[model samples]
Target: MNLTEQVLHVLDNALSLQGRTAGFTRDTPLLGALPELDSMAVLALLTGLENHFGITFSDDDLRGTVFATVGSLSALVEQGLARQDP
Candidate 1:
């Protein structure tokens, strides 16, 4: 699956969104827009992403801008993977 689909799936499962994430697009606001995206949800999302992508996230890496939009979050994942190359 593409990044968006993968992200949506992760969000759906992590938040128990009940498929509500189907309506999300690249423009979907996440950081401050969704009430469900509070501190706990942010931690859940971070853990889910680390597990799903098999990557690590330092506390310094968890910036609000990274989770601003679906596209931005996906791009951050892609960038993280890219950095893993030898």
Candidate 2:
């Protein structure tokens, strides 16, 4: 799967959203929008992403904007994955 799909998978698994993410477009707002996206859920999502993608996130990457949407989070992870490439 691509980064976005992987992120969606991670999100679904992390939040146990039970396919609720099927309706999520790239612009789907998270953070203050989704009640499922609390701070703890964010941490779980991060862990899920890291584990599934084999990447590590720095403290600087924990900004609220990173979790702003499905697209934003996937973009962040995409950038991080790009940085890991040589």
Q: Which candidate ranks first by lDDT, i.e. highest? A: 2
Q: What's the lDDT of the predicted structure labeled candidate 1?
A: 0.84
- For candidate 2, the 10 contiguous residues with the lowest summed lDDT are 1-10
Tell me each candidate's TM-score.
0.90, 0.94
RMSD of each: 1.2, 0.9
What Cα-based lDDT does every candidate model obtain? Answer: 0.84, 0.88
lDDT of 2 by residue, 6-69 (tens): 7998899999999998888889998888898887998899998889988899998778799888
Tens-place lDDT digits, model 1, residues 1-86: 88779888888787778998899998888888888888899889878987898888777777889889888888778877777878
Instruction: Using TM-score, give the best candidate's number.
Output: 2
The ten-residue window of minimal lDDT in model 1 covers 55-64
- Backbone clashes in model 2, listed as residue pairs: none
